[model samples]
Each structure stands twice: as structure tokens, then as C-alpha cells.
Target: MRRPQLLHLGGRPRQHAEREPRHRRFCRSSVALTVGLLLTGCAGGVEPGDAASPGPAALPEGVAVEIVQLRADVAVRQAQVHIVNGSDADLEIGDVAVDDPRFVAPATRVLPGRTSRVPAGGEVDIRVQLPDVACARDDVEPSEPTVALGFTVDGAAGTARVTADDPLGFLAPLHERECRAAALAEAATLAFTGFMPAPTGEPARLELTVTPTGGGSATLVAVQATNLLDFGPATVDGAFPLDVTVAPDDIAPIVVDIPILPSRCDPHAVQEDKRGTIFDVRLTLAGDPGEIELFVGDALRGDILTWVSSWCGFAGTP
Candidate 1:
């Protein structure tokens, strides 16, 4: 075999007598070559023109979108959307599309067609009209609706779909108001005909003509009182533990006795002259398990309080 060469530290050639073994020389050379190849591969993998490629688009930063109002009438569903552009650049908002088909672009003058440009670090409000089907149904859980907002950031177009997490609790209040109105309307069918004040040592009376909607004989099970001014429960005697029955379609006059209790007339309580101090009389009918609440208008509440004051010997106290 031919003699193997040894490399000196300073590029000096070693003589045959001082040369390393052939296998050792070969191993050293292979290692050096492998390391060189690795460095070359890494350098070649990166494209020279990659610097020209556009950088990743910046997402909407510090942006806030909320549902300010969600209203549903008998015919149309409406939503007032509020958007705040917290980004550094002005955002051009384009057409807004909702995932639900029931929501459509609002046609109201308050919120005209799209192309709303929100200034940097500013807020904008837009109204979106929805179909009647989009209204919250009693059977379904209240879910915050989402909309896909088409916007351009930094002059580059993009779409950001956002869901309105109701921070204001708007849906619950709306539903409650609607339900209360419906209950009041249903109770109106049982026309209130008269109000009778009791004589000395007797309780005051309210006469209501009960006409069952189903045209079947119904019984009054219980009656609860609520104060309209405070939205709290009120007191009523001869209303609960009720066992009064009425014939169908015939004017079955029912009377509820008003008590002369301290709760009905408080001398220290603020007495306002408006109709706000009314009572909501909730009547529980036999056939319907739900209570039908009827409002005693301002005029009626005033009259009732006056009668109660006279009976309690505190007349003209206010």
C-alpha cells in the first residue's frame, strides 16, 4: 500500500517516516468533507428572491365589535351593531354578512348601506335588519349572534368574522318586557268592570268579569300582587288560596278584596302623583297553569289608595 500523508498544523508536509496510518487520514478527510457539504446545503436551501415575497398580513389588533341593540317586532328583526377600531390605521368596513340567513342588511335611514369607514381609534355604529325568523324563540337558548365583517386594514382587504359576546345583557331584558306585554294583553280579555270600596270594618273589593278564552268553565286558583313602581311583590288579601269558579262565555263577576295593611299604604313612603304606583294583579286560572298579570292603571291605583287611606283612618295623610 502507498504511504499515507500527515497534515501539519502550519501546512507543512510530513515525511514518510512521520506519516499517520492510511485509515486515520481517510477518516479525518471524510469528516471534513461531510461538514463542508452540510454548510453548502443549508446555504443553497434559502431562495435569494424570498425577500420580495409579501409579509404575512397583520390581523385586526385591538378591535372591538359589539351588539348594542337587538330588537324584534312582529314583522322584522333588527340589530344595532357598534364597532370600535382600535388599530393604528383607518379601517374601511365593507359589506357585513351574518352566518344566520335571517339577518340581512338594514335599510333604515339610521344605518344606510355599507361602506362605513371607521377612523383609527374611533367607534362606529351600524344597524343590521334581520328576518322575523332570526328573532329569539322561547324554545331556543339565547345565543349571541355573529357576523362576518369585511374590512380593509392598511389598504389591504380582508374579512374578520366576529361573534358578539353580549356584555350588556340586552336579550334577557327584551324577552322579559315582551313576555310581560303578552301576559297583560291576555289578561285584558277578562275585562275589569268595577272597583268597590268596603264599608267600615270591611275590606275593599275589585270586580273582574272572567270570560275564558277556550269557552270552558274556569276557576280562579290564586292571585298574587306586584308593585309596579318598585317591581317588587305586593300584599293582597282574599286573592290567594282562591276557589272561585266562573261559567264559560257568561259574565262571571269575580271580586278580589283589597286589605287595609301597612304594606298597602305606608305613611313614610314617598308618594308620587303619577301612575307609577300601580299594582300588577297576577291571576292564576284553573285551565292555564301560568299566571295572567293585569295592570291596575295609574288612575285605578290612585283611587284604590285613596279608598284604602279612608278605611285605615289615615285619610289625607299624604
Candidate 2:
């Protein structure tokens, strides 16, 4: 993946203003901010009867199972499960069950064409809502044994068992959960979007938005800024770069307006050169554990528009 270059807002003067009350609706109070990430499926087919397969031999004769995404951290709260049909005939999954009391597989159902297919692959989302009883009462040591997965195929005599690999494989869901939690923690806070030259030709303006998770507060104190002009011909810097404060419950659009003049060098291409003068604003923030998530938007002459994203967690938690 290519990393987008962020502009530095340093050396460009800024004008600060208070956030309006009407624009304060994006920040919700105490709702779960689910950061959904689609896990990519592996290439080719999962080998039948492999350790990663979800079914045991000499039991139910039906669809085969494959574990795609496993993690040790469960903070992310959700996971994606994949299964590939390896039988000569169509196979059916009656239901999926987790024997472990601590693990909860919320979503378990065969997709339409993907299910009951020969040499076909399918997936289901496994949500982890570890009960307080398990999280609080369970003192299971790291070296202790774990449970297996029970799969009841359609019209099967008995349930098949998929013994989970102790430690690493069994706790795979937890790891993904933690990563998502870290992302939510980072995302539900303040992040700097960077500075851009305002149309009014004043000090360069810095634009950023703050998103909040239901827990804790964060403050953005701008300590340093760096300016770069390698991408385009224009350059802008902050005159007096200082700390900027962002309240936790405040999910508002903060714009620091500044004054900047375009520098043109060519004679015949002066207007085009002036338009190309682009300076990237890069800012350093002093705040809680989180990252700066980047969102890029493109417009094609007002006819078509699109947006892309790459997250940069602030405070290093993401």
C-alpha cells in the first residue's frame, strides 16, 4: 500500500476560532464505535483434514471447515470465519457451536451459493461477547487445555469436532478484537487532517476533525510542525505554531485560518505554477494513546467524487 504524503502546517500563520454549537452533532455520547475491517481471504482452497480444518474425522460426514482469521486479543469484539467445501458432493452445515464456555460465536450461518457447494468457499462473522462471568471468574492459566468446535452437518448422524490449537489458535479472536479496540480508541479521539492554502490568501489554514469513543478524554497540544514542498511548486509554513486544545466531548470541525500568498516562477505558466504551489502540513500532537487516521477525498469537476482512508493512530495506541 502506498502511504499518502501529509503536508506540514508549520511557518503558516493561523487564526483560531471557537467551534459552533450546530456542528457538534458528530460526537455521540456513550455509543459503541464499531470500526469494521473486512479480512482478506487466502488464495486457493484450504487443504481438507488439515489442522486448520474445522471438522474431526470419523464423525459427521459433511462440509469441511477452515479457520481464516484467529487472534489472541479479543478487544476487537468481532471476527470473520471462512469455510471451504472439499467434498465431492454438496455439503451442508446444520449449525456451528463453540464448546468453550468463554468463546461466543455470534454469527454462524452458511451463505446462499457458497454453502452447500462442492469446491466452494464461504465465510461467517464470529462476534465475541465474552460474558462478565467468563472474563471475571475464569482463572484458566496460559498452559491449560482448551475446548473444540462442534459442527452439525445436515442429516449427519453425529456432530464433528474441530479441536482448537491451544494458546495461539484458540485465542486468535482476542487478538483481532484488541486491534479493533485500539483503533476505536484512537479513532474516537482527535486527529489532525493537515493544513491547506485558503482561497482568501491569508495564513495557511489547518483543518481537522475529532471523533470520540465512549471512554476517556483527549487534548491536542500542537508542539511542532514541519513544512514540505516536494510534491508541488508552492510552499507554506506556520508563523507561530503553538499548542491547540481539543475537548473530549467536543466532536466539532476546527479550522485555523491563516494567510498565504502563492509563489509563481514561470512567465507564461505563472497562473498554472501558482495553482501548483502545494505545501504539505505535518503536525505533531501531544495527547493520549491514539493515532491520526487519514481520509482523502477527490472530486472530478463536480460530476464524480470519492474518498479513501488510511489510519494514523494518535498517541501510538493504534
Candidate 3:
């Protein structure tokens, strides 16, 4: 017998080749599993409840915000926030969040999904709603409450602070009324000195010193005088020139001369102190065209009329 036809099949053994295939398959499976895990991670494997990461750095330039109007009724309180885009590029407002505990809004209306487009050099108004209780508290003084606004300008996130002017008037009716009254009171202070005869024989003159009392200046526009009895014009309707400017806490002297005509006077009644003469003077201020009732005291009125009567040669009973 060919003692042993025990010849090797090839240079390598079959057992080693079979084991090599198994090893390669195991390695491929392991690599696929690892790559699958990594891809899943990249494609939002994070939980839904996870907090959002911080946004990109820097905010778009030339964006401004201001509180234009605030209104409050029994049901809701709302503020109109005016946003101005001063830059040349259009702005996409992603969302606006007022970091005030008093404010509240529906999540659907706040941000991310709700967006506003503002063209360059244009402006937009956004409404911010708050609880009515927030406006219920009284504000004793003029307070400019600063509010923080968190919003995105052209996809860039930023925070800004705005100073609101007199937003507390919604609290109480008396609050606004008192504020207006105080402002009107502080607008000016008037003093009536004695009257004197004018150099012009037909008219009598009086001196008035007007002083501005508040933090602002006042421009005296015009003054009108009317008789209390018949509402007749006591002085020429447009005779006095009142283009006077009074600085804050400064005084300006004005002289008013009126024609002392006896056509509307009752000499007998004037003789009797019972039917005294009264005149109502109205002072008009520039910018605020509303007439401010100027005080002409009873004594001052009597003095003015007495001088007029003497100048007109009617100083006797009818």
C-alpha cells in the first residue's frame, strides 16, 4: 500500500480558513452595530424633555423696541410693543418673551412657531397680554418700569431692556386723574398785580407775571378776556401779543392793555358794589392748545374796572 497517500490538501489548513470567515463576520457585525448607534445619536436620540441648548452668539444690529400703548379693562391687560427695524436688512422676529411674572401668553403664540417679518426701515406692533391683577396696584409716583425682552432678531437671539412710561395708569382711575391734575397745576403760576393807565388814552393796562412751575418749559401763545355778565369780549379778541417763553421755574412779565369802552357798562350798577364786575381770562399755551382758566381775583377785577371807568370819564351813578 502506498504507505500513506497522506498528502496535505494545500499550503493552508481548511479549519483555519473556516474560522477566519467567522471572525470577519463577527467584526463586520460589531462595526455595523457601533455605526448604527452613532447615526442614531446624531439624528436626535435626545429625549423630548431635554432642555434646549443656548443659541448662537450675537444679535442683529439696529433693532429697537418701545412700548407704544397699554390698555387694561376688566378682562385683560395688553401692551402694544413697537419694534423698529433700522437696519438695511429685513428682520425675522422669532419670538418675544417678556421676563415679567405679571405677563402671560399662550405657548402657541409666543415663539419658535410664531414669527413676524419686519421689512427694513419698517416697524411692527406686537401685543403683550398680562393679567388684570398686575394693573390693579396703585402707583404713587411717576415710575418708568424697565422690562426685559427676550427675542430673536434675524435668527440671532438677544435680550433687551425697555423703559416704559407711566404704565401704571391702568390701576385706578384716580391715578390718572390725579396725575393730570398735578401736571396742570404745575404747568404755570400766575400773579395779578395792580392796573395802571396806558399812555394811549383809550385803553387801560395791567401787569401779569407768569412763571413756569414744572420740569418743562412753557410757551404763552395768547390770552383772551370776556365779561362775566354778558360774555362780551372784555379786551380785543386778539390784541395782546403772547409769544413769550418761560423756562422751568422762571418768570416772564406780560403787559395787557385793553380798550376801556363804556358801551357795555351799566354806570348805576357799577356804582352799586352789589352788581360787581367780573372778567374771565383764558390763557392758551402752545403745543397744548387747550385753554387754561387764568385766575383774575375779584379785587383785581374791581381795580381794573375802576381804572377803566375813571379813564373813560364815567365815574358816576347813571
Writing each residue's lDDT as its tens digit, candidate 1 over 99-131 gives 432222322323445477777655555555543
Q: How accurate is candidate 3 locally (lDDT)?
A: 0.41
Q: What is the TM-score of each candidate against the true structure?
A: 0.38, 0.32, 0.33
Model 2, span 1-318: residue lDDT tens: 001112111111111122123112211210111010011111122235455544323322222333322221122222223332323332343334333434333233222212222222222222223322133224643321121233334433223444322312534334333333344454354333544543322334444444555454444333222221121213323322323444445565455433233222222222112112222222332343332212222121011000000011112110
Q: Worst 10-residue stretch by lDDT in candidate 3?
A: 1-10
Q: What is the lDDT of every predicted structure here?
A: 0.44, 0.29, 0.41
Query: What digit string (tens of lDDT, one per residue) describes model 3 on residues 1-318?
Result: 000112121111222233454334334333343343233313322223323734323223544444432212111223444454545776655445443322222211211345566676555555554332232233434343333444455455544444332223442342333333234445666555555554324545556666566565566555544332221254345334456666666644444443333334555534533222323233334455444334445566566556545645675422
What is the overall TM-score of model 1 with all chains considered together? 0.38
Total backbone clashes of candidate 2, pairs 3 or more residues apart or in separate chains? 44
TM-score of predicted model 3?
Answer: 0.33
Error of 3 at 149 (Å): 55
Q: By TM-score, who's the top model here? A: 1
Distance from true position, residue 288, model 1, in Å?
9.1
RMSD of 1: 27.9
